[model samples]
Target: MKNMDVMLLSTSCIQSQLMKELLSESLGPSITLVNQHTFAYHDWNKPALILVDLANLPTSNQPWELYLRGFKDNISTVLLNTQDSISAQKLLQWPNVYGYFSHYEDQETLIRGLTKVLKGEHWIPRSMLIEMLLYLQSIKPITTTSIELTSREIDVLNLLSNGKSNTEIANELFVSEHTIKSHLYKAFKKINVKNRVQAKRWARCHLPLYDG
Candidate 1:
Protein backbone atom coordinates (compact mmCIF):
# COMPACT_ATOMS: atom_id res chain seq x y z
CA MET A 1 0.00 0.00 0.00
CA LYS A 2 2.90 2.34 0.62
CA ASN A 3 5.21 3.74 -2.01
CA MET A 4 8.74 2.39 -2.31
CA ASP A 5 11.74 4.71 -2.16
CA VAL A 6 14.58 3.58 -4.45
CA MET A 7 18.10 4.81 -4.97
CA LEU A 8 19.92 4.34 -8.27
CA LEU A 9 23.70 4.30 -8.35
CA SER A 10 25.35 3.96 -11.74
CA THR A 11 28.29 5.39 -13.60
CA SER A 12 26.53 5.23 -16.91
CA CYS A 13 24.11 8.08 -17.56
CA ILE A 14 22.18 6.04 -20.11
CA GLN A 15 21.71 3.09 -17.81
CA SER A 16 20.52 5.34 -15.02
CA GLN A 17 17.98 7.02 -17.30
CA LEU A 18 16.76 3.67 -18.60
CA MET A 19 16.25 2.29 -15.12
CA LYS A 20 14.38 5.41 -14.02
CA GLU A 21 12.08 5.16 -16.97
CA LEU A 22 11.44 1.45 -16.54
CA LEU A 23 10.81 1.74 -12.82
CA SER A 24 8.49 4.68 -13.22
CA GLU A 25 6.51 2.91 -15.89
CA SER A 26 6.31 -0.33 -13.96
CA LEU A 27 5.82 0.88 -10.39
CA GLY A 28 3.92 4.09 -11.16
CA PRO A 29 4.73 7.66 -10.20
CA SER A 30 4.42 7.20 -6.45
CA ILE A 31 7.90 5.67 -6.27
CA THR A 32 10.65 8.15 -5.39
CA LEU A 33 13.98 7.99 -7.19
CA VAL A 34 17.37 9.33 -6.17
CA ASN A 35 20.23 9.13 -8.63
CA GLN A 36 23.75 9.48 -7.36
CA HIS A 37 27.31 8.69 -8.34
CA THR A 38 28.19 7.70 -4.77
CA PHE A 39 26.44 7.54 -1.41
CA ALA A 40 27.69 7.61 2.16
CA TYR A 41 26.85 4.54 4.19
CA HIS A 42 25.68 6.53 7.22
CA ASP A 43 23.12 8.65 5.42
CA TRP A 44 20.12 9.14 7.69
CA ASN A 45 17.38 8.68 5.11
CA LYS A 46 17.50 5.06 4.00
CA PRO A 47 15.87 3.91 0.79
CA ALA A 48 13.75 0.80 0.53
CA LEU A 49 15.81 -0.48 -2.41
CA ILE A 50 19.22 0.23 -3.92
CA LEU A 51 20.18 -0.67 -7.49
CA VAL A 52 23.87 -0.64 -8.26
CA ASP A 53 25.76 -1.29 -11.50
CA LEU A 54 28.86 -3.02 -10.26
CA ALA A 55 30.74 -2.95 -13.54
CA ASN A 56 30.31 0.75 -13.99
CA LEU A 57 31.49 1.63 -10.52
CA PRO A 58 35.13 2.31 -9.88
CA THR A 59 37.28 -0.61 -8.79
CA SER A 60 37.24 -0.68 -5.03
CA ASN A 61 38.03 -3.85 -3.12
CA GLN A 62 34.87 -3.78 -1.04
CA PRO A 63 32.47 -1.02 -2.00
CA TRP A 64 29.57 -3.43 -2.08
CA GLU A 65 30.75 -5.08 1.10
CA LEU A 66 30.80 -1.76 2.94
CA TYR A 67 27.36 -0.83 1.69
CA LEU A 68 25.92 -4.25 2.55
CA ARG A 69 27.43 -4.14 6.04
CA GLY A 70 25.95 -0.71 6.66
CA PHE A 71 22.45 -1.59 5.47
CA LYS A 72 22.51 -5.32 6.07
CA ASP A 73 19.02 -5.83 7.47
CA ASN A 74 17.39 -2.60 6.39
CA ILE A 75 17.55 -2.41 2.60
CA SER A 76 17.30 -4.68 -0.41
CA THR A 77 20.02 -4.43 -3.05
CA VAL A 78 19.99 -5.30 -6.76
CA LEU A 79 23.19 -5.76 -8.67
CA LEU A 80 22.86 -4.92 -12.36
CA ASN A 81 25.45 -6.09 -14.84
CA THR A 82 26.03 -7.75 -18.14
CA GLN A 83 26.47 -11.53 -18.08
CA ASP A 84 30.08 -11.26 -19.21
CA SER A 85 30.91 -8.64 -16.64
CA ILE A 86 29.88 -10.74 -13.61
CA SER A 87 30.63 -14.36 -12.94
CA ALA A 88 28.46 -16.82 -11.06
CA GLN A 89 31.31 -17.62 -8.65
CA LYS A 90 31.43 -14.07 -7.35
CA LEU A 91 27.66 -13.55 -7.41
CA LEU A 92 26.91 -16.43 -5.07
CA GLN A 93 29.06 -14.93 -2.31
CA TRP A 94 27.09 -11.70 -1.89
CA PRO A 95 24.59 -12.37 0.86
CA ASN A 96 22.78 -9.06 0.92
CA VAL A 97 22.48 -8.59 -2.79
CA TYR A 98 18.87 -9.51 -3.44
CA GLY A 99 19.09 -9.99 -7.18
CA TYR A 100 21.26 -9.93 -10.30
CA PHE A 101 19.71 -8.94 -13.63
CA SER A 102 21.55 -8.63 -16.86
CA HIS A 103 21.59 -5.30 -18.64
CA TYR A 104 20.88 -7.13 -21.88
CA GLU A 105 17.86 -8.91 -20.45
CA ASP A 106 14.42 -8.27 -21.81
CA GLN A 107 12.32 -5.55 -20.22
CA GLU A 108 9.88 -8.08 -18.80
CA THR A 109 12.64 -9.95 -16.98
CA LEU A 110 13.94 -6.74 -15.49
CA ILE A 111 10.47 -5.72 -14.37
CA ARG A 112 9.85 -9.16 -12.93
CA GLY A 113 13.12 -9.08 -11.03
CA LEU A 114 12.32 -5.70 -9.54
CA THR A 115 8.84 -6.80 -8.58
CA LYS A 116 10.12 -10.00 -7.01
CA VAL A 117 12.75 -8.07 -5.07
CA LEU A 118 10.08 -5.66 -3.85
CA LYS A 119 7.96 -8.60 -2.76
CA GLY A 120 10.83 -10.00 -0.65
CA GLU A 121 12.15 -12.72 -2.92
CA HIS A 122 15.56 -13.29 -4.40
CA TRP A 123 15.90 -12.99 -8.18
CA ILE A 124 18.88 -14.79 -9.58
CA PRO A 125 19.38 -15.70 -13.20
CA ARG A 126 18.62 -19.32 -14.06
CA SER A 127 22.06 -19.97 -15.47
CA MET A 128 23.74 -18.29 -12.54
CA LEU A 129 21.65 -20.31 -10.12
CA ILE A 130 22.67 -23.53 -11.79
CA GLU A 131 26.28 -22.48 -11.72
CA MET A 132 26.04 -21.69 -8.02
CA LEU A 133 24.56 -25.11 -7.28
CA LEU A 134 27.31 -26.78 -9.25
CA TYR A 135 29.97 -24.81 -7.44
CA LEU A 136 28.47 -25.80 -4.09
CA GLN A 137 28.40 -29.42 -5.11
CA SER A 138 31.98 -29.36 -6.34
CA ILE A 139 33.40 -28.22 -3.02
CA LYS A 140 34.63 -31.15 -0.93
CA PRO A 141 32.85 -31.42 2.41
CA ILE A 142 34.90 -30.80 5.52
CA THR A 143 35.02 -33.74 7.92
CA THR A 144 35.98 -31.74 10.99
CA THR A 145 34.09 -32.13 14.23
CA SER A 146 31.32 -29.69 14.97
CA ILE A 147 32.14 -26.82 17.28
CA GLU A 148 29.75 -25.01 19.57
CA LEU A 149 29.78 -21.28 19.05
CA THR A 150 27.74 -18.59 20.70
CA SER A 151 25.56 -16.40 18.52
CA ARG A 152 28.00 -13.55 18.98
CA GLU A 153 30.86 -15.80 18.04
CA ILE A 154 29.08 -16.80 14.87
CA ASP A 155 28.59 -13.15 14.02
CA VAL A 156 32.27 -12.52 14.53
CA LEU A 157 33.14 -15.45 12.29
CA ASN A 158 30.81 -14.18 9.59
CA LEU A 159 32.47 -10.78 9.62
CA LEU A 160 35.90 -12.30 9.63
CA SER A 161 35.02 -14.44 6.61
CA ASN A 162 34.15 -11.27 4.76
CA GLY A 163 37.72 -10.02 5.29
CA LYS A 164 36.85 -7.41 7.90
CA SER A 165 39.36 -6.32 10.52
CA ASN A 166 38.57 -6.21 14.24
CA THR A 167 38.04 -2.47 14.24
CA GLU A 168 35.78 -2.55 11.18
CA ILE A 169 33.77 -5.43 12.56
CA ALA A 170 33.44 -3.70 15.90
CA ASN A 171 32.28 -0.48 14.30
CA GLU A 172 29.75 -2.29 12.12
CA LEU A 173 28.28 -4.37 14.96
CA PHE A 174 28.27 -1.48 17.45
CA VAL A 175 30.37 -3.37 19.95
CA SER A 176 33.31 -2.04 21.91
CA GLU A 177 36.74 -2.74 20.39
CA HIS A 178 37.74 -4.80 23.42
CA THR A 179 34.59 -6.87 23.16
CA ILE A 180 35.40 -7.78 19.56
CA LYS A 181 38.84 -9.02 20.55
CA SER A 182 37.27 -11.07 23.33
CA HIS A 183 34.80 -12.66 20.92
CA LEU A 184 37.53 -13.46 18.43
CA TYR A 185 39.63 -15.10 21.12
CA LYS A 186 36.76 -17.28 22.27
CA ALA A 187 35.77 -18.14 18.69
CA PHE A 188 39.29 -19.23 17.79
CA LYS A 189 39.47 -21.42 20.89
CA LYS A 190 36.06 -23.01 20.24
CA ILE A 191 36.83 -23.72 16.60
CA ASN A 192 40.32 -24.92 17.52
CA VAL A 193 41.90 -22.39 15.24
CA LYS A 194 45.20 -20.58 15.78
CA ASN A 195 44.36 -17.35 13.99
CA ARG A 196 41.70 -15.34 12.19
CA VAL A 197 42.61 -16.73 8.73
CA GLN A 198 42.05 -20.29 9.84
CA ALA A 199 38.74 -19.31 11.39
CA LYS A 200 37.67 -17.79 8.10
CA ARG A 201 38.60 -20.95 6.20
CA TRP A 202 36.62 -23.06 8.67
CA ALA A 203 33.64 -20.79 8.36
CA ARG A 204 33.62 -20.93 4.57
CA CYS A 205 33.65 -24.72 4.73
CA HIS A 206 30.84 -25.14 7.25
CA LEU A 207 28.60 -22.05 7.26
CA PRO A 208 26.38 -20.59 4.60
CA LEU A 209 28.03 -17.23 4.63
CA TYR A 210 26.13 -15.79 1.67
CA ASP A 211 22.71 -17.36 2.06
CA GLY A 212 21.30 -15.02 4.66
Candidate 2:
Protein backbone atom coordinates (compact mmCIF):
# COMPACT_ATOMS: atom_id res chain seq x y z
CA MET A 1 0.00 0.00 0.00
CA LYS A 2 3.05 2.31 -0.01
CA ASN A 3 2.38 3.15 -3.66
CA MET A 4 -1.25 4.05 -2.89
CA ASP A 5 -1.92 7.75 -2.19
CA VAL A 6 -4.18 8.83 0.70
CA MET A 7 -5.69 12.24 -0.08
CA LEU A 8 -6.19 14.60 2.84
CA LEU A 9 -8.44 17.55 1.92
CA SER A 10 -8.42 20.65 4.08
CA THR A 11 -8.51 24.45 3.83
CA SER A 12 -6.47 25.32 6.90
CA CYS A 13 -2.70 25.50 6.50
CA ILE A 14 -1.97 24.54 10.14
CA GLN A 15 -4.39 21.59 10.13
CA SER A 16 -3.13 20.42 6.74
CA GLN A 17 0.38 20.21 8.19
CA LEU A 18 -0.73 18.58 11.47
CA MET A 19 -2.89 15.88 9.85
CA LYS A 20 -0.18 15.24 7.27
CA GLU A 21 2.39 14.63 10.03
CA LEU A 22 -0.09 12.45 11.95
CA LEU A 23 -0.87 10.22 8.96
CA SER A 24 2.73 10.02 7.83
CA GLU A 25 4.03 9.28 11.34
CA SER A 26 1.32 6.89 12.54
CA LEU A 27 0.13 5.22 9.33
CA GLY A 28 3.15 5.65 7.01
CA PRO A 29 4.80 8.19 4.72
CA SER A 30 2.51 7.58 1.71
CA ILE A 31 0.04 10.30 2.76
CA THR A 32 -0.29 13.26 0.38
CA LEU A 33 -1.93 16.51 1.44
CA VAL A 34 -3.96 18.13 -1.34
CA ASN A 35 -6.42 20.95 -1.66
CA GLN A 36 -8.90 21.72 -4.48
CA HIS A 37 -6.18 23.44 -6.51
CA THR A 38 -3.74 20.51 -6.36
CA PHE A 39 -6.24 17.62 -6.26
CA ALA A 40 -6.93 17.69 -10.02
CA TYR A 41 -3.23 17.60 -10.82
CA HIS A 42 -2.73 14.33 -8.88
CA ASP A 43 -5.56 12.32 -10.45
CA TRP A 44 -2.97 10.11 -12.14
CA ASN A 45 -1.80 8.88 -8.67
CA LYS A 46 -5.31 7.54 -8.00
CA PRO A 47 -5.70 8.04 -4.26
CA ALA A 48 -7.21 4.97 -2.55
CA LEU A 49 -9.06 6.89 0.13
CA ILE A 50 -10.02 10.52 0.80
CA LEU A 51 -10.06 11.81 4.37
CA VAL A 52 -12.21 14.93 4.10
CA ASP A 53 -11.62 17.54 6.83
CA LEU A 54 -15.02 19.14 6.52
CA ALA A 55 -14.40 21.57 9.40
CA ASN A 56 -12.12 23.72 7.25
CA LEU A 57 -13.31 23.21 3.69
CA PRO A 58 -16.32 24.90 2.13
CA THR A 59 -18.01 21.60 1.26
CA SER A 60 -20.96 22.97 -0.73
CA ASN A 61 -18.92 24.60 -3.51
CA GLN A 62 -16.47 21.72 -4.06
CA PRO A 63 -18.78 19.50 -6.18
CA TRP A 64 -17.67 16.70 -3.81
CA GLU A 65 -20.60 14.60 -4.98
CA LEU A 66 -19.44 14.77 -8.58
CA TYR A 67 -15.85 14.09 -7.49
CA LEU A 68 -17.10 10.92 -5.78
CA ARG A 69 -19.17 10.13 -8.87
CA GLY A 70 -16.08 10.25 -11.07
CA PHE A 71 -14.25 7.81 -8.79
CA LYS A 72 -16.85 5.12 -9.61
CA ASP A 73 -16.05 2.05 -7.47
CA ASN A 74 -12.43 2.70 -6.57
CA ILE A 75 -12.05 5.37 -3.91
CA SER A 76 -13.33 5.13 -0.31
CA THR A 77 -14.34 8.43 1.39
CA VAL A 78 -14.38 9.38 5.05
CA LEU A 79 -15.57 12.58 6.80
CA LEU A 80 -14.06 14.09 9.93
CA ASN A 81 -13.68 17.27 12.06
CA THR A 82 -17.35 18.06 12.38
CA GLN A 83 -19.04 19.99 15.22
CA ASP A 84 -22.11 17.85 15.60
CA SER A 85 -22.17 14.07 15.28
CA ILE A 86 -25.96 13.97 15.46
CA SER A 87 -26.43 16.57 12.72
CA ALA A 88 -23.54 15.09 10.76
CA GLN A 89 -25.39 11.74 10.88
CA LYS A 90 -26.95 12.60 7.52
CA LEU A 91 -23.65 12.11 5.65
CA LEU A 92 -23.95 8.37 6.33
CA GLN A 93 -26.77 8.37 3.78
CA TRP A 94 -24.15 8.71 1.05
CA PRO A 95 -22.70 5.43 -0.17
CA ASN A 96 -19.19 6.80 -0.66
CA VAL A 97 -18.77 7.82 3.00
CA TYR A 98 -17.98 4.38 4.46
CA GLY A 99 -16.24 5.84 7.50
CA TYR A 100 -16.99 8.73 9.87
CA PHE A 101 -15.01 9.77 12.94
CA SER A 102 -15.36 12.92 14.97
CA HIS A 103 -12.13 14.92 14.87
CA TYR A 104 -12.20 15.37 18.63
CA GLU A 105 -11.50 11.66 19.13
CA ASP A 106 -8.03 10.53 20.22
CA GLN A 107 -5.37 9.87 17.58
CA GLU A 108 -5.40 6.16 18.51
CA THR A 109 -9.13 5.92 17.81
CA LEU A 110 -8.71 7.72 14.48
CA ILE A 111 -5.92 5.32 13.56
CA ARG A 112 -8.17 2.37 14.37
CA GLY A 113 -10.91 3.96 12.23
CA LEU A 114 -8.53 4.46 9.30
CA THR A 115 -7.32 0.87 9.61
CA LYS A 116 -10.89 -0.41 9.42
CA VAL A 117 -11.73 1.91 6.52
CA LEU A 118 -8.67 0.80 4.52
CA LYS A 119 -9.66 -2.81 5.19
CA GLY A 120 -12.95 -2.10 3.32
CA GLU A 121 -14.97 -1.92 6.54
CA HIS A 122 -17.21 0.92 7.81
CA TRP A 123 -16.29 3.05 10.89
CA ILE A 124 -19.24 5.20 11.87
CA PRO A 125 -20.02 6.06 15.50
CA ARG A 126 -22.50 3.51 16.88
CA SER A 127 -24.79 6.24 18.21
CA MET A 128 -24.81 7.92 14.80
CA LEU A 129 -26.29 4.77 13.27
CA ILE A 130 -29.01 4.69 15.89
CA GLU A 131 -29.70 8.38 15.28
CA MET A 132 -29.73 7.73 11.53
CA LEU A 133 -32.36 5.00 11.93
CA LEU A 134 -34.57 7.19 14.11
CA TYR A 135 -34.09 10.09 11.72
CA LEU A 136 -35.05 7.92 8.75
CA GLN A 137 -38.14 6.72 10.55
CA SER A 138 -39.10 10.33 11.31
CA ILE A 139 -38.75 11.41 7.69
CA LYS A 140 -40.35 8.36 6.14
CA PRO A 141 -43.60 9.54 4.62
CA ILE A 142 -46.68 7.45 5.37
CA THR A 143 -48.23 8.92 2.18
CA THR A 144 -51.72 8.70 3.63
CA THR A 145 -52.54 12.31 2.77
CA SER A 146 -50.57 12.20 -0.46
CA ILE A 147 -52.04 9.03 -1.98
CA GLU A 148 -55.28 8.90 -3.99
CA LEU A 149 -57.36 5.84 -3.02
CA THR A 150 -60.64 4.74 -4.59
CA SER A 151 -63.94 4.76 -2.66
CA ARG A 152 -64.34 0.95 -2.69
CA GLU A 153 -60.71 0.53 -1.66
CA ILE A 154 -61.29 3.14 1.06
CA ASP A 155 -64.28 1.12 2.31
CA VAL A 156 -62.23 -2.04 2.59
CA LEU A 157 -59.34 -0.13 4.16
CA ASN A 158 -61.63 1.56 6.70
CA LEU A 159 -63.08 -1.77 7.83
CA LEU A 160 -59.62 -3.28 7.88
CA SER A 161 -58.33 -0.37 9.96
CA ASN A 162 -61.24 -0.84 12.37
CA GLY A 163 -59.99 -4.41 13.03
CA LYS A 164 -62.48 -6.20 10.77
CA SER A 165 -61.18 -9.43 9.27
CA ASN A 166 -61.42 -9.99 5.51
CA THR A 167 -64.47 -12.25 5.90
CA GLU A 168 -66.08 -9.87 8.43
CA ILE A 169 -65.56 -6.88 6.13
CA ALA A 170 -67.01 -8.82 3.21
CA ASN A 171 -70.14 -9.63 5.24
CA GLU A 172 -70.55 -6.03 6.49
CA LEU A 173 -70.16 -4.61 2.97
CA PHE A 174 -72.44 -7.37 1.50
CA VAL A 175 -69.58 -8.30 -0.90
CA SER A 176 -67.94 -11.64 -1.67
CA GLU A 177 -64.67 -12.51 0.07
CA HIS A 178 -62.95 -12.50 -3.34
CA THR A 179 -64.25 -8.96 -3.99
CA ILE A 180 -62.97 -7.79 -0.61
CA LYS A 181 -59.54 -9.30 -1.23
CA SER A 182 -59.39 -7.64 -4.61
CA HIS A 183 -60.23 -4.26 -3.05
CA LEU A 184 -57.53 -4.80 -0.37
CA TYR A 185 -54.89 -5.72 -2.96
CA LYS A 186 -55.71 -2.61 -4.98
CA ALA A 187 -55.64 -0.40 -1.88
CA PHE A 188 -52.24 -1.73 -0.92
CA LYS A 189 -50.94 -0.96 -4.37
CA LYS A 190 -52.40 2.57 -4.44
CA ILE A 191 -51.04 3.50 -1.02
CA ASN A 192 -47.75 1.63 -1.59
CA VAL A 193 -48.13 -0.67 1.42
CA LYS A 194 -47.71 -4.44 1.88
CA ASN A 195 -49.61 -5.89 4.85
CA ARG A 196 -52.88 -5.32 6.79
CA VAL A 197 -51.17 -3.30 9.58
CA GLN A 198 -49.66 -0.79 7.16
CA ALA A 199 -52.97 -0.58 5.28
CA LYS A 200 -54.74 0.15 8.57
CA ARG A 201 -52.32 2.96 9.48
CA TRP A 202 -52.74 4.50 6.04
CA ALA A 203 -56.54 4.30 6.24
CA ARG A 204 -56.73 5.79 9.74
CA CYS A 205 -54.57 8.78 8.77
CA HIS A 206 -56.13 9.41 5.33
CA LEU A 207 -59.77 8.51 5.92
CA PRO A 208 -60.95 11.40 8.13
CA LEU A 209 -63.04 12.70 5.18
CA TYR A 210 -64.14 9.22 4.17
CA ASP A 211 -67.85 8.41 4.64
CA GLY A 212 -67.74 4.94 3.03
Candidate 3:
Protein backbone atom coordinates (compact mmCIF):
# COMPACT_ATOMS: atom_id res chain seq x y z
CA MET A 1 0.00 0.00 0.00
CA LYS A 2 3.02 2.22 0.05
CA ASN A 3 2.97 5.09 -2.48
CA MET A 4 -0.65 4.22 -3.36
CA ASP A 5 -3.95 5.96 -2.68
CA VAL A 6 -6.75 4.41 -0.64
CA MET A 7 -10.34 5.40 -1.46
CA LEU A 8 -13.14 5.45 1.06
CA LEU A 9 -16.73 5.26 -0.19
CA SER A 10 -19.71 5.79 2.10
CA THR A 11 -22.96 7.77 2.22
CA SER A 12 -22.80 8.76 5.88
CA CYS A 13 -20.75 11.89 6.48
CA ILE A 14 -20.01 11.00 10.07
CA GLN A 15 -18.97 7.44 9.39
CA SER A 16 -16.79 8.50 6.48
CA GLN A 17 -15.17 11.27 8.49
CA LEU A 18 -14.47 9.03 11.46
CA MET A 19 -12.93 6.40 9.27
CA LYS A 20 -10.91 9.04 7.46
CA GLU A 21 -9.36 10.17 10.73
CA LEU A 22 -8.55 6.61 11.79
CA LEU A 23 -7.10 5.68 8.43
CA SER A 24 -5.23 8.94 8.06
CA GLU A 25 -3.44 8.36 11.34
CA SER A 26 -1.94 5.15 9.92
CA LEU A 27 -2.06 5.75 6.17
CA GLY A 28 -1.14 9.45 6.33
CA PRO A 29 -1.18 11.17 2.90
CA SER A 30 -2.26 8.10 0.97
CA ILE A 31 -5.93 8.33 1.98
CA THR A 32 -8.53 10.03 -0.24
CA LEU A 33 -12.12 10.65 0.81
CA VAL A 34 -15.09 10.34 -1.57
CA ASN A 35 -18.81 10.21 -1.00
CA GLN A 36 -20.93 7.62 -2.72
CA HIS A 37 -22.80 10.12 -4.87
CA THR A 38 -19.76 12.04 -6.14
CA PHE A 39 -17.76 9.00 -7.23
CA ALA A 40 -18.94 8.97 -10.84
CA TYR A 41 -17.86 12.58 -11.29
CA HIS A 42 -14.39 12.08 -9.84
CA ASP A 43 -11.50 11.69 -12.25
CA TRP A 44 -9.28 9.54 -10.05
CA ASN A 45 -7.46 6.39 -11.02
CA LYS A 46 -8.35 3.05 -9.48
CA PRO A 47 -7.01 3.04 -5.95
CA ALA A 48 -4.70 0.56 -4.24
CA LEU A 49 -7.38 -0.29 -1.71
CA ILE A 50 -11.11 0.42 -1.65
CA LEU A 51 -12.50 0.55 1.89
CA VAL A 52 -16.29 0.40 2.10
CA ASP A 53 -18.58 1.15 5.04
CA LEU A 54 -21.43 -1.19 4.25
CA ALA A 55 -23.50 -0.22 7.29
CA ASN A 56 -24.26 3.31 6.10
CA LEU A 57 -25.26 2.34 2.57
CA PRO A 58 -28.89 1.91 1.47
CA THR A 59 -30.17 -1.68 1.19
CA SER A 60 -33.29 -1.17 -0.91
CA ASN A 61 -31.63 -2.34 -4.13
CA GLN A 62 -30.67 -5.81 -2.93
CA PRO A 63 -28.25 -6.08 0.02
CA TRP A 64 -24.78 -6.19 -1.59
CA GLU A 65 -25.76 -3.96 -4.53
CA LEU A 66 -24.43 -0.80 -2.88
CA TYR A 67 -21.09 -2.40 -2.07
CA LEU A 68 -20.56 -3.68 -5.59
CA ARG A 69 -21.82 -0.58 -7.38
CA GLY A 70 -18.48 1.14 -8.00
CA PHE A 71 -16.03 -1.49 -6.87
CA LYS A 72 -12.94 -2.20 -9.00
CA ASP A 73 -11.88 -5.82 -9.33
CA ASN A 74 -8.20 -4.90 -9.69
CA ILE A 75 -8.10 -3.21 -6.30
CA SER A 76 -8.19 -4.91 -2.93
CA THR A 77 -11.37 -4.23 -0.87
CA VAL A 78 -12.04 -4.22 2.85
CA LEU A 79 -15.51 -4.02 4.40
CA LEU A 80 -15.86 -1.71 7.38
CA ASN A 81 -17.59 -2.88 10.55
CA THR A 82 -18.96 -6.17 9.19
CA GLN A 83 -19.33 -7.65 12.70
CA ASP A 84 -20.63 -11.20 13.13
CA SER A 85 -23.72 -11.14 10.96
CA ILE A 86 -24.55 -14.47 9.30
CA SER A 87 -24.46 -12.85 5.86
CA ALA A 88 -21.01 -11.39 6.45
CA GLN A 89 -19.44 -14.80 6.15
CA LYS A 90 -20.85 -15.16 2.65
CA LEU A 91 -19.71 -11.67 1.65
CA LEU A 92 -16.16 -12.52 2.73
CA GLN A 93 -15.81 -14.96 -0.14
CA TRP A 94 -16.48 -12.40 -2.86
CA PRO A 95 -13.59 -11.69 -5.26
CA ASN A 96 -11.16 -8.80 -4.50
CA VAL A 97 -12.17 -8.77 -0.84
CA TYR A 98 -8.92 -8.69 1.16
CA GLY A 99 -10.39 -8.39 4.65
CA TYR A 100 -13.14 -6.98 6.88
CA PHE A 101 -13.42 -5.01 10.09
CA SER A 102 -15.71 -6.64 12.63
CA HIS A 103 -17.92 -4.31 14.68
CA TYR A 104 -16.54 -6.02 17.77
CA GLU A 105 -12.89 -5.17 16.95
CA ASP A 106 -11.15 -2.21 18.43
CA GLN A 107 -9.92 0.74 16.37
CA GLU A 108 -6.35 -0.51 16.68
CA THR A 109 -7.38 -3.88 15.32
CA LEU A 110 -8.92 -2.18 12.33
CA ILE A 111 -5.61 -0.51 11.56
CA ARG A 112 -3.79 -3.81 11.85
CA GLY A 113 -6.25 -5.52 9.52
CA LEU A 114 -5.90 -2.75 6.98
CA THR A 115 -2.13 -3.00 7.13
CA LYS A 116 -2.37 -6.74 6.61
CA VAL A 117 -4.56 -6.32 3.55
CA LEU A 118 -2.23 -3.66 2.22
CA LYS A 119 0.62 -6.13 2.48
CA GLY A 120 -1.23 -8.54 0.16
CA GLU A 121 -2.49 -10.83 2.88
CA HIS A 122 -6.11 -11.67 3.58
CA TRP A 123 -7.42 -10.83 7.02
CA ILE A 124 -10.41 -12.86 8.18
CA PRO A 125 -11.70 -14.14 11.46
CA ARG A 126 -10.38 -17.56 12.44
CA SER A 127 -13.85 -18.73 13.37
CA MET A 128 -15.29 -17.90 9.96
CA LEU A 129 -12.38 -19.59 8.15
CA ILE A 130 -12.79 -22.73 10.25
CA GLU A 131 -16.55 -22.70 9.74
CA MET A 132 -16.11 -22.53 5.96
CA LEU A 133 -13.60 -25.39 6.03
CA LEU A 134 -15.94 -27.53 8.15
CA TYR A 135 -18.85 -26.82 5.86
CA LEU A 136 -16.86 -27.96 2.83
CA GLN A 137 -15.61 -30.97 4.75
CA SER A 138 -19.17 -31.94 5.68
CA ILE A 139 -20.51 -32.34 2.14
CA LYS A 140 -22.06 -35.81 2.44
CA PRO A 141 -20.58 -38.27 -0.03
CA ILE A 142 -23.11 -39.23 -2.67
CA THR A 143 -23.98 -42.94 -2.75
CA THR A 144 -22.72 -43.66 -6.28
CA THR A 145 -21.80 -47.34 -6.36
CA SER A 146 -24.81 -47.90 -8.61
CA ILE A 147 -23.90 -45.01 -10.90
CA GLU A 148 -21.32 -44.93 -13.68
CA LEU A 149 -19.25 -42.11 -15.16
CA THR A 150 -17.45 -41.68 -18.46
CA SER A 151 -13.76 -40.74 -18.55
CA ARG A 152 -14.72 -37.32 -19.91
CA GLU A 153 -17.16 -36.82 -17.07
CA ILE A 154 -14.41 -37.55 -14.57
CA ASP A 155 -12.14 -35.02 -16.32
CA VAL A 156 -14.86 -32.36 -16.10
CA LEU A 157 -15.43 -32.96 -12.40
CA ASN A 158 -11.72 -32.97 -11.62
CA LEU A 159 -11.14 -29.68 -13.40
CA LEU A 160 -14.26 -28.10 -11.95
CA SER A 161 -13.17 -29.17 -8.48
CA ASN A 162 -9.86 -27.46 -9.10
CA GLY A 163 -11.68 -24.13 -9.73
CA LYS A 164 -11.53 -24.19 -13.52
CA SER A 165 -14.39 -22.42 -15.26
CA ASN A 166 -16.40 -24.36 -17.81
CA THR A 167 -14.63 -22.51 -20.61
CA GLU A 168 -11.24 -23.35 -19.11
CA ILE A 169 -12.20 -26.98 -18.72
CA ALA A 170 -13.45 -27.02 -22.28
CA ASN A 171 -10.25 -25.49 -23.58
CA GLU A 172 -8.15 -27.95 -21.62
CA LEU A 173 -10.19 -30.96 -22.74
CA PHE A 174 -10.25 -29.85 -26.39
CA VAL A 175 -14.05 -29.60 -26.34
CA SER A 176 -16.60 -26.82 -26.77
CA GLU A 177 -18.06 -25.01 -23.76
CA HIS A 178 -21.47 -26.37 -24.73
CA THR A 179 -20.12 -29.88 -24.47
CA ILE A 180 -18.58 -29.07 -21.09
CA LYS A 181 -21.91 -27.74 -19.86
CA SER A 182 -23.68 -30.84 -21.07
CA HIS A 183 -21.17 -33.01 -19.25
CA LEU A 184 -21.59 -30.92 -16.07
CA TYR A 185 -25.37 -31.06 -16.22
CA LYS A 186 -25.24 -34.83 -16.51
CA ALA A 187 -22.61 -35.06 -13.79
CA PHE A 188 -24.79 -32.94 -11.51
CA LYS A 189 -27.73 -35.27 -12.09
CA LYS A 190 -25.67 -38.36 -11.42
CA ILE A 191 -24.06 -37.03 -8.25
CA ASN A 192 -27.13 -35.16 -6.93
CA VAL A 193 -25.18 -31.88 -6.77
CA LYS A 194 -26.73 -28.62 -7.91
CA ASN A 195 -23.83 -26.33 -8.83
CA ARG A 196 -20.09 -26.11 -9.40
CA VAL A 197 -19.43 -25.00 -5.82
CA GLN A 198 -21.34 -27.99 -4.46
CA ALA A 199 -19.63 -30.28 -6.93
CA LYS A 200 -16.23 -29.03 -5.79
CA ARG A 201 -17.08 -29.73 -2.16
CA TRP A 202 -18.28 -33.19 -3.06
CA ALA A 203 -15.17 -33.86 -5.11
CA ARG A 204 -12.87 -32.72 -2.34
CA CYS A 205 -14.69 -34.74 0.28
CA HIS A 206 -15.20 -37.89 -1.76
CA LEU A 207 -12.82 -37.98 -4.74
CA PRO A 208 -9.48 -38.69 -3.04
CA LEU A 209 -9.63 -42.32 -4.10
CA TYR A 210 -10.90 -41.40 -7.55
CA ASP A 211 -7.97 -41.72 -9.98
CA GLY A 212 -9.52 -39.18 -12.32
Candidate 2 C-alpha error for residue 85, in Å: 4.2
lDDT of each: 0.66, 0.67, 0.66
For candidate 2, write residues 1-212 as lDDT tens digits.
33456878776498688988888788764677887555654554454677878777775313343244244355667887766533533474343677777758788998987877777688876877677667656553434566766655655676687788988776655569999899888778888899998887766666652223
Q: Which stretches of candidate 2 lie over 4 Å from their true place?
A: 1-3, 44-47, 64-66, 85-89, 93-95, 131-212
Among all candidates shown, the one with the greatest lDDT: 2
- lDDT: the better of candidates 1 and 2: 2
Could you tell me the C-alpha RMSD of candidate 3 in Å?
A: 10.7
Please give each candidate's TM-score.
Answer: 0.59, 0.53, 0.53
* TM-score for predicted model 2 compared with the true structure: 0.53
lDDT (Cα, tens digit) per residue for candidate 1, span 97-165? 778877677878888877778777888767777887888787654333567776567667877888889
Spell out the clash pairs found in candidate 3.
Answer: none
Angstrom error of the Cα, residue 69, model 1: value is 5.1
Model 2: ten consecutive residues of lowest lDDT: 60-69
After superposing candidate 1 on the true structure, give the runs of residues whose Cα lies further than 4 Å from its correct spot.
Answer: 1-5, 10-18, 29-47, 67-74, 82-85, 96-98, 106-109, 119-122, 138-179, 197-212
